[model samples]
Target: MTALKRRGTFAYFLVLVTMLLVWPMGVILMWAYTPWSKSVKVAITICLTILTVLTVHSVCYFRIMPS
Candidate 1:
């Protein structure tokens, strides 16, 4: 039963983390698409790319390797 509870809690934590991650990606993308300057767009694009890579790494770390 304890393992079940832990698993449930972990699932909730993953959901929460995913939700948290979605907000920033959405926000950055929204701004990235707007009629902004090229430099600003490039900066956010770089940030978004880096953010995407990091998020993928995080998911692999948390979801793939965990017992």
Candidate 2:
């Protein structure tokens, strides 16, 4: 594979792994390093934001009270 292809593959894996494990950094990396268009990035950003909001709301709404 060409150097550019290898770099792109590496960036892809890095973004995927980081998105699962450490997502704030992953967003930055996706915007800065990946070849995705602005619209795709914006869509993913919106989805991630919505997911985060839902997760936070679920946790806050479902917390157990101490006896």
Candidate 3:
């Protein structure tokens, strides 16, 4: 069982935006301190995982041509 804290709405939103836009490592690190719920944390992890995979896919497929 994990101990949860009481962080306000702003912190919650910050974590969310951090999860979406910031580096995935940052979000993963924040999970230890942030007071967001388990579900929210899970959602963040899922979203980051999906986005990272997509990002990797895009990078792999991207073609650079000198014109």
Structure candidate 2, residue pairs in collision: none
Residue by residue across 35-56, what tens digits does model 1's lDDT show? Answer: 5577865775577678789989
Worst window of 10 by summed lDDT in candidate 2 = 58-67
TM-score of 1: 0.44
Kindly report which residue pairs in candidate 3 clash with one another.
none
Ranking by TM-score: 2, 3, 1
Task: Give the higher-TM-score candidate: 1 or 3.
Answer: 3
TM-score of each: 0.44, 0.88, 0.55
Instruction: Write candidate 3's Cα lDDT for 1-67 as tens digits.
Output: 3233334555666666776577575577568767668997788688778888998888777754334
Q: State residue 30's C-alpha deviation in candidate 2, in Å.
A: 0.4
Per-residue error for 65 in candidate 1, Å, reads 1.8
After superposing candidate 2 on the true structure, give the runs of residues whose Cα lies further than 4 Å from its correct spot.
64-67
Candidate 3: list runs displaced more than 4 Å.
Answer: 1-22, 64-67
Estimate the overall C-alpha local distance difference test score of candidate 2: 0.89
Top model by TM-score, which number? 2
- List the global CA lDDT of all models: 0.64, 0.89, 0.68
Better of 2 and 3 by lDDT: 2
